[model samples]
Target chain A: MDKRLALILSEVFRLKEKEINIALTKADVGSWDSLKQMDLVLTLEREYNILLTIPDILRMVSVAGIVDVLREKGVALED
Target chain B: MVALVTGGGKGLGLVIAEHLLSNGATVVVVDRDRDALDALPTSVFGKCLDVTQPEEARTVVASVVKEHGRIDVLVNNAGVIYNEPLVNIMKPEGIMHDYGRFREAVTVNLDSVFIMTCAVVEQMVLLRTKGVIVNISSISACGNEGQTAYAAAKAGVNAMTVTWSKELGRCGIRCNAVAPGFIGTESTHQALSVDSIKHILQNTPLGRLGKAQEVAQAVATVIENEFINGVILDVNGGLVI
Candidate 1:
């Protein structure tokens, strides 16, 4: 889950692998905005091949929240 | 003088058509919306056109030249937009649920611009007329959320603006673009929330939503100013940094 979340964050925000710390938020990242937020949601859904509702997108505000939503959707982490 | 304005039936296009008519230029409003065309003033020439179809574009241009004798100004103002996030767009859901809207937006906004511009340029060259083309770009060209396809397309428009300027400059023709910010159109006003409006105002030094007339005025200025070529005139009230 951690690795997949990192990959999604890095690609959507165009951040380096090291820049995608778990503590990342809209304030910590300059590129983070409503538009990028939407893009991030889309990228996650595409990457995981899962459907995210508008409610899910609106509720996801942090890295942990994103992981929790993915877990709720039953996306298993690779061991 | 014959002037062709793609998507001239409403909003910015309508304003441009009215402005050109006031300037004594015969205006041709080309759009796919027949009902919208019917609503336009009778003095303006309204043609039902699907500009993405290159052959139709050629036919429309030829018909205009045959009727009007010469071409002078071509304004590519017809465009569409999709506000959904890209992920929801790529899902394998039904057409309406997925990125189908994005495909249409790209076709109408981006592809049509290329087809129409090329068609007009060919006519201008064959007629040996020194012409002007005003491409209606957007603030999104600099990048915006929920507008990946649109931003890419407008960016392409800006690039083509510069490239066409160079290609057509030696032919005594000019090509430029008008990148508009938020305007006070009914649709825009409806789509944006009060906070979104406030945010836009705060970012814009002018502290106001731009008017369609203001954008039309800029387009007119670009058309008249032969010295301004391959330049994108930003009418976004300084919204873009």
Candidate 2:
């Protein structure tokens, strides 16, 4: 699940796989603007088959942040 | 199966309603024009409705479900167009259109679709029927001359098609859109001059305008195909890339 989420984030933000740092928030990534944030939210929701609330979507700012949300939704992730 | 078509009074909407009915699905048609609704065949279930009226959408949706067990298909095909560019063509001193025209374009084309879809989808969820929605877009969705408002609304339909498919897929409902080019409908025949029509044909790869039946075939195909989801199927005859 982590691998899939990372890939989707990388693709949406147009970042190289190696450049997709867990600490890189939307403020850090040049491409992760508000519009791309919405795209990421939609993509993540579709990819994981989870419905995200507006608050959850707004809080999604980085890879670690996404992993936390997915985990809350009971999405099993690789250790 | 049961289906509902907006703007089924005339032009392409009428053809789509007939096509679905002929394919063994019962149909309910709604239109703002009383005259157009009256002209339909006696067998068709017709309603003279102005969808823009706030309460009409919910009332019509409820009535259709009450009469029919369920609506398995919905075609959001109601729309209007004004071929006025950003700059005034009719009067050089004024702008292309007043604020009212712009509001009317978005209201009729975009708002009506959103309202009707929500109303139908709510019932579909309650009944737990796997429903299908097909939105009729236009080639102008990409961009077209004198279609500032129409293009925006059609493009909004395309976006909703994709968004709804994702959001509603869990409920077993699927959504798609069809963007058509110039079609030889009664409205098109009356709107464009012979010389302008000739120019359009010359530019079209098929060397002729599309028939309404041809578009009906595409809409029916989408409804029949279970695998196609979140697709903006272009029925244009290669007019644009």
Compared with the true structure, what per-residue lDDT tens digits does model 1 show for residues B60-117?
Answer: 9989988998889999999875565554422334313245666787888889989998
Poorly placed runs, candidate 1 (over 4 Å):
A1-79, B88-100
Write the residue-wise lDDT of candidate 2 on A1-79 in tens digits: 3577668877997777777766878667765544566678778778889998766765677678777888899888774
Candidate 2: stretches off by over 4 Å: A1-79, B89-93
TM-scores vs. true structure, each candidate: 0.75, 0.73
DockQ for each model: 0.09, 0.01
Model 1 chain B scores worst on lDDT over the 10 consecutive residues at B88-97
lDDT agreement of model 2 with the native: 0.83
Top TM-score model:
1
Error of 2 at B140 (Å): 0.5
- Candidate 2's residue-wise lDDT over B1-241, tens digit each? 9999999998899999999989998999999999999999876799977777758888988899999989999999998865555654224245346668878998898988898898899999999999999999988888776678888889899999999999999999999998888898877877565655776788889888998998999999999999889999888787863
Q: What share of the true interface contacts does candidate 2 keep?
A: 0.00
Report per-candidate TM-score of chain A alone. 0.81, 0.88
